[model samples]
Target: MSSEVVRFEASEEFARRMDAEDSLRSFREEFLFPVHDGEPAIYFVGNSLGLQPRKAKTYVLEALEDWEKLGVEGHFRGTRPWMPYHEMLTEQTARLVGAHPIEVVVMNTLSVNLHLMMVSFYQPTRERPKILMEAGAFPSDQYAVASQVRFHGYDPDKDILRLAPREGEETLRTEDILDTIERHGREIALVLLGNVNYLTGQAFDMAAITRAAHKQGCRVGFDLAHGAGNLQLSLHDDGPDFAVWCSYKYLNGGPGTLGGVFVHERHAHNKALPRFAGWWGHDKQTRFQMGPDFEPIPGAEGWLLSNPPIFQLAALRASLELFDRATMPALRRKSDRLTAYLEFLLDRLPPGVVRITTPRDPKQRGAQLSLRFSKDPRRLLEKLNSAGVHCDFRSPDIIRAAPAPLYNSFHDVYRFVGVLERHARD
Candidate 1:
């Protein structure tokens, strides 16, 4: 249902009724929630760390059992062998980000994958030596980009271009982004952006940005840390050189789990491309031969620098099964409605008590709603936690509350708003 057609009511009965009518409500039972008092806490922090999936333990145990029984032989003997285990995630990971299986691979952590991608794609020359990125990006990304530029013997202050929102604006305008690319395209060797900005919950026009960057002979990539499971992405159609994301947040892969990478199919068989190689990324047919030369496997797997952690892969596999069953289209549909309902309820608060930093249009965001409070946001966060509303506080004032459609119900959103209302009144 579109937001314009449905008029939302702010009563407890309304919230329960919506939850009752939800098609995806059963999926909520699959996850384990944190307890507040005796009841399940109102979990709206999926944008940070997602709740653990109940099946994760079972999956991990299967791996452990195999390891104990077969030892080194488990590499080739188990139901899901350790040797080609990462391949098991390729198709599902591709579907999640809308890419070909050949283009996707499950491997190292997000930053590690990001640095690997930059090594090949961020080939800065004397004429075009700059890296373009969003201002106020996540600190990790800022540090990564700065260090990359410095490693190439370029001064980050001189070579890195950080784009910011206009004066007094909380989010970026798409037109301005395109204009900047048009003007600076010649000097930029690469353009890296968060597919969805972590702070303001702003989703960018990635396709447009990619096209603009390509027109200027610049390679483009995205950090999908907030976008992967939360947004319905079309990375292949969008035509970015590469993209990377972690599985711990919206993906529910447990804490500090594995990450994924997408490399466009056009570059799949380019063995001459410079990369940090490892034995695992070698061609399967001759990998056991222990050849001195690295005959890199075609596509995204070719970028792997080491063998992955099997336990983390097992944990992520459990969540990917849920995603495959739930489907991004269905999840995205419910996410829009849930976020709209949250916005409607937040709008009812007294003027100047709070301001939403996220875009009002659902097209421009994911499940997260960033709330900027007029009062002590940290104190309010403490009250919300005490009252069984679980969310996260960013520095200064913003509180990011994400109602994950796979687990969070409309009633959860309602109860959360009720707590915020009481605190605002106080």
Candidate 2:
């Protein structure tokens, strides 16, 4: 159902009716939700860890069986050869992020990829040594950027420029971001941001930020941990120099699974660009020759460090297959409606009971809604969890509930709000 056309109602029957009319509703059966009191709990924390795809077991066991049957030859002779296992994911991953196959690669975890990207893209000249990033970014990103600055013998406190929301504001304004880039473009070596802020659920305008940064001659990148599977991204068109994301969250690749990286096609063949390379990144033909010299692959694959864990690749392949079948455009359409429905229901609660910190504009947010309670937010979170609602709490009184469109229903949103409403009355 188109969000613009449907009139939302605050009733269970209405929620069920919307779910019944949903086109992607059947996709929910593909995942296994957690059980509480012998029924599927309201799993609304896909922003942290996605539910397991049923096919993940099949894919994982297939890889294990291949290893048992083929021994070391499994690398060369399996249903999906272990040696080239990562290749199976390339096309679907590229499609997920709206990048060309050459620009995307599945490799290390999010922080590792971020560090690797910085190694090549965060080159700090004597004049342009500062890194501009959003304040309160995911701690790992902040740490990585700081360490990189220190490695270059620059003081992080002086070289790192942190942009914060205006006083009394929960999210940063696009104009402010662009203006900051414009003002510090010369001193800034890179602009790194989490496209969707984890705590506030604010989705930045990536394309606009990219254009502004490029105009000022600064390298730009994003940490898309929350944006990846939740948002309809156009990394190639958006033209960020690089971007990285974890597969464990919205991507449903299991806990701590492999992450993905996108190095724009413009940077793909730049072999002269300094990078920490490994044998897996060498030309496949020459890799087995045990050559002393490293000849990196021509695209994103060149950044790969070592052979990937085959089991993780298999599990992620299962999820990526579903992503290919469902398509981001379809998922995004449902996501808009699901999130809107959730917002609509939450708004009906008595004012001052809870405040939503996420942007009300759908374009400025994703599926997750960050709720700030007027009092005892942690108590509310505990109450909600014990009541079989699965969500997460951040420090300083915020509970994040993400109704993932792929596996969540309007009924889930309705029930979640019912829980909140009942608890708020207490």
Candidate 3:
């Protein structure tokens, strides 16, 4: 279908009516929004900085109070203490990724966790030391991979392999990925890919990619920064060796928060595996003994470098509790409908004015829609910002807008589309 062919009157009044009837409408009131021109700004930036949950403050305050009262004894003294804090959240996060509690652990930031995972899984023999990743991975991940290869005394410029979309294709096809893995399997030590690409919102096929990599004796890992809370992950069934994700984007854990890393159960008992560790990763019983030698714990916790920030965990705990209520299936249903509605409205725009670059199939994407304006990208973004319709612009051409189902209603999307059409037309 063409942009000019679709019919829908996306207007403020229409949006308000939709909100009034939406089942998830009440959630919009729970998040803090940017104020522009003395009114709450439309927040389409959840893919970058998720809107803060009201309960986040309460959770952090409780942790603060615990710190104030318990002091040095706070490790086991408070209600949600320093001890066993991250473990408390493992089960819920595992459910989000469809894995066992032993397979998942919330730990350091995404890049850090990726580095730690690489230490264990990216063991490259001289014959097969090259690491394979997307061509335009988020800069942080690129840096982590390069630094890791360098740390191993290998030159990243020659050893790192990059996979780009085929000529003239904006997004990569699944067949190309499988072909690359099969062709280079023996020389490829690891395949680290994004579950949902950050720029194009193209969701990759995890199960197939894992299978192809495994067939060639190459281990696989995923950088799920955009996938974690937005899509249903078959982490256990797909069986990647390891994976990492940030909580702040879709998990609503707060800025620069700790994140999750998954180590498949098969690797859980591999005591011979190489790992960079900390006192927390030591046997909890022997940790306080302050021994000279380090014995690692089993599973994901064995990769921990230190105890995580409890304040961040507190926020994650509250957010995961909400997930337990909404469940992935319920949120996905709303995501599909709301995003389709947004696409329908945007398609009503003038021909060639706005293009929906995100995949059309509901099964191929998450909640985000990335748009390309044939006009000046910066001007279009500023125009929306001035109109009180908040959205984000990825440099060059694409603007990413996410109608988060947990707190975003159908009307918010309707209003955003209405504002976009008016501005793009005027």
lDDT of 1 by residue, 1-426 (tens): 332456689999999988887888999999999998898999999888998999999999999999999999888998689988988999999999999999999989999999999999999999999999998799999999999999999999999999999999989999998999999999999999999999999999999999999999999999999999999999999999999999999999989999999999999999877788888888889988987999999999888878889999999999999999999998999999899999999999899988999999889999999999888889999989889888999976799999999999999989999889999666
Candidate 1 vs 3: which has more TM-score: 1
Instruction: Please list the residue runs of candidate 1 whose C-alpha ends up more than 4 Å from where it truly belongs after superposition.
Output: 1-4
Clashes per model (N, Cα, C within 3 A):
0, 0, 0
Q: Estimate each model's TM-score.
A: 0.98, 0.99, 0.94
lDDT of 2 by residue, 314-380 (tens): 9999889988999999999999989998999888889898888999999999999999888788888
Score residue 152 of candidate 3 by CA lDDT: 85
Runs off by more than 4 Å, candidate 2:
2-4
- Output the worst ten-in-a-row residue range by lDDT, candidate 1: 1-10
Look at candidate 1 and give me any clashing residue pairs.
none
Best by TM-score: 2
Reference-based lDDT, residue 200, model 2 = 96
* Count of clashes in candidate 1: 0
What lDDT does each candidate get? 0.92, 0.94, 0.86
Model 3, total clashes: 0
Off by more than 4 A, model 3 = 1-23, 36-39
lDDT by residue (tens digit), candidate 3, 1-426: 112322345676755665565566666677777787896777777889787888999989998998899887888887777898888898899899989988999999998899989999999889999898998788899999999899888889888988898887777888989999988899999999999989989899999999999999999999999999899888999999999999998889899998899999999989888888788889888998999998888888888878888999999888888877778777777677778888988887789888888889888899899999888878888999888877788866899999888888777787787788788766
Residue 369 CA error for candidate 1 (Å)?
0.8
Among all windows of ten consecutive residues in candidate 2, which has the lowest summed lDDT? 1-10
Candidate order by TM-score, decreasing, is 2, 1, 3
lDDT (C-alpha) at residue 110 in model 1 = 93
